[model samples]
Target chain A: MKGIYFLVILALVTAVDIIVPYFFIGGIASLAACYLFWSALTFAVIVFAIIYTSQWGRRS
Target chain B: MKPLYVWIAMLGWTAIALWIAAAARKKMRPGASEFFIGGRRLRGFVSGMTYAATTYSAFMLVGLVGLTYRLGVGALGFEMTYLIFTVLLLITFGPRFWIVGNWYGHITPPELLAHRYKNQWVAVIAAAISFFMLIPYASAQLMGMGFLVDGITGGSIPFMIGVFIMAGLSGFSALYAGMRSVAWTDAFQAVTMMATSIIALLFTLYHFFGSPAMFAAEAARKTPELLKFTWTPELFIGLSLPWAFFALTNPQVSQRMYIPDSVVSLRRMVIYFSLFGFLYTIISTLFGLEAAIVIPGLENPDKAMPHLLGKVPVMLGVIIFVGIFAAATSTLGSIILTLSSLFARDIAKHFYPEIPENTERWLGRIVILLLLGACIVFAWFQPGLITVISSMASGGLLVMAPAIIAAFFWRRATAAGALVSMGLGGVITAVMYLANIYPLGWWPSVWGGAITLLLFAGVSLVTTPPDDADRFISSVERELVARGFRRH
Candidate 1:
């Protein structure tokens, strides 16, 4: 599930890189894409943190 | 405008930074581990700020502005790639590093590599390459400081002296308090940089265009290419990929993972660092674009920031100068500390096993001073091709990224394979860059990284997996467990 989310986000970003310039979004598309990239990355970090922290707690 | 006030403000900031260093020193022990890694007690916010400040550096502010000014919006691709690369770094490697560093008492990348590969020679060679590559990088920051001071002061102070002052302060910070001082200073610098960037953007946008739409239209009118998001295939594949890889594998950056307090802090750092990197890039690029509209066709694109700030209110110019210095010094301090640690822990410890901890700490300090002196001498030579130096260093480090990734993930990876791939990757990229065989034009990073990754994957597939592969992987798993992260 995590890997799937990563792939979907990456695909969306790549699509933005490809399609946004064709239309007249006027650079906002690039900005939005950058934000989405950051969001996805942040989500991944949170997921890892939750997993790691929970595991640590269990072991103790 | 009173020049004296500007000098006073700069000096005042320097004194505050020094006081913080003094305070940190009093509380900390004087040993290599304590000095270099801050006794491994840094919290999420401090580590995150340090990572962002060091990663962004003066290059992003001055050099990146110039790049955007010349290359237009396509340069944002470099920034985007960096964001992606850093995210990949944290998710895949950060937790592992935090656990391994604490568990094995690893101080440097090569130290960990040495233990994993069971070869001290590998660690020595890796350290040598990393330390030498860092020289040009550190010198570039010094050169940037020199340029910033000269630009702001209008040549009252010699560029060399400016370089010396910034570099000397950075050296002192690293020597006095090590990573602890560097991390605290970075937090302060990061805040100042973000504030200055926001103020500069607000002022530039108001003075030029009242709205986002107006700003885009104006930029389009001045340079239509500025609005375009296209890059040639050569650039997309050749330049972008290498930079992305470098964002992960560069020893300076990878080492940051070693210093975070815990796995949870490491996780928080990833989010904060990505946001910080994204915001900094967008604002800096916008500043460059606005500068393009204000001052058309300046021979040096690097002058965009200074030129734009010069037109702003006098008070803002002083603030911007301070911010630029912050960007440069924060980066320089981290680089100096990393280089010193690499020398002391990786090189000296491997060769001379009997050195006392205090002696090693002194060796690290002396190494910092020597590096500073060497950079000063290098700065005096003043290479005409500053961008080339940056690109070459980036390329060299990109060659090592694949090996690093494989070392972590691929159980089949061997010491010989790692070394061969990196060496060949670096060599091929250098030859191609010098010969200019392709139309790629000034992008060794892509070529080097592609070749390196291919070689690494190929060699790992053909060779027998390391005997300790399962054990190492399990250890990492246990570390995650210890950190409260459960396996899927």
Candidate 2:
């Protein structure tokens, strides 16, 4: 909800974004699944941030 | 290939865009700042839509599609990383930019920097750097339009014609009502881009492969190499690093931070842009993946989208081409308008204190025309060195990140420090890029960012801080608190 929390989420999402692809170069089926999942996960983090930030905006 | 359909789509789209511009002109006010920043009265939706339109250009559908087609899942990760960083940056600094912009009535981002650091040279140098760096990039957007048209028309229409048409249309968009017209058209174009791309993507999936799952299966079965994440760490970082800080570095989008009418609107701007970016990134990257399955072993990766278009129905292909045109025009128009503001406010008006505001507005319009002309020439010439410049554009801009970030967060930052870091760092990165020298197997952006941050910090620590460093930072903070942003 706050800047620090937002920053933490940013770092986590970015790390996953990089590390997952680097380490999980699996076979075709697994790789397709990984790409979709990782992409969705990264966007979901931003969606959460937007919700939190707007709530914070309203409260402030 | 139904070149006629492409022409018809473009003509119809241009008519609609011009009508929007005419409508925008009716509401326009006088003066350079009003024209450039829409008098800073944009609503949240318009603000968000224009920001999204400007930030996600033809590159998403064309360049990015090609990148994804070539590199695999790494393209998605790289793009998603940019989105994530942008959202976080907006949440953190968007408020600060809005508060300071309101307090000072700043017209351009560089002007804000000059004010914070209390140095005219800062604004001048920053504007000059923007001028030098953004023109070729803008021209490339026009070049993109040319290539798309040329390819779609099968050489019936030449490349220069595409360049001219785009240059003329974008120039008109900027010349009409400045930011107001550009923003209105951008909102329209942004919608067109998403809708057309989505329809095409779904059609590609259902018509060609029966379903999303089927398409994925086919892709996995045939071009599994694309699904596999085989990007080297060096490749990934080089490509993604500059883009991660794009929110702060690229003035076209960064200037949007000053446009929202209220704190709530600014918040909505971030939320809306983030959502649009999220959907659009997925769509573009998926298009890239689909291209791999649909058309394999293309000689040029960048040709993936064009090749895919050839296989689609004529009407759908033309509509998608129009979307790409919309994307490129919206971006080109915004960049021209923003850069004109930079020239008029930070460079021209600074030296000519006696110039009237009305004259300043006219100056900006003239600059818009001249800028478009220059871009058209560059795009038409199609020089060999442009490849290097195009490759270096993001990283070159990345050199400004430390200076901008420090301007808001670090009170000890001096004008000299900001200037040196941006100037030296930009040159160093550009030289290394041009010389084909990547130290340590890392990208220029990584090296540029590291050096810029260190230089900014080291220089600021030894130099004299701006006399009002504490006042500027605290007052902005106080304003942020008043606007509802929490402070620890």
True contacts kept of each: 0.16, 0.44
| TM-score of chain A for the candidates in order shown | 0.43, 0.57
How would you class the docking of model 2? acceptable
Residue by residue across B1-488, what tens digits does model 2's lDDT show? Answer: 76677778888999999999999999998776679999998999989999999988877887788888887877887788888888888988888888888888988999889998899888887888788778888887887777778777778888888888888889999998989999999999999998998999999889889998888778888878778877778888888888888898888889999998887888889988998998898899888988888888987666688889988988889879988999999999999999999988899978996888888888899999999989988888764432234446778888888778778778899998989998888888877876888898998878988998888899999999998999888777766666667644
Best by TM-score: 2
lDDT of 1 by residue, B187-291 (tens): 888988899888878877887788766887677666776656556656654555655665455677778888877765776676678768777888888877787
Best by lDDT: 2
In order of appearance, the predictions have TM-scores of 0.89, 0.96
The C-alpha stretches of model 1 lying farther than 4 A from their native spots are A1-60, B1-5, B211-213, B384-388, B430-442, B461-465
Report model 2's TM-score to 2 decimal places: 0.96
lDDT of 2 by residue, A1-60 (tens): 244565677788777777666765434454446677667776786777666565445434
Listed per candidate, the RMSD to the true structure in angstroms reads: 3.5, 2.0
Please tell me the interface RMSD, in Å, for model 1: 5.5
- Which pairs clash in the backbone of model 1? A51-B485, A51-B486, A52-B484, A52-B485, A53-B484, A53-B485, A54-B484, A55-B484, A56-B484
The candidate 2 chain B region of ten consecutive residues with least summed lDDT is B383-392
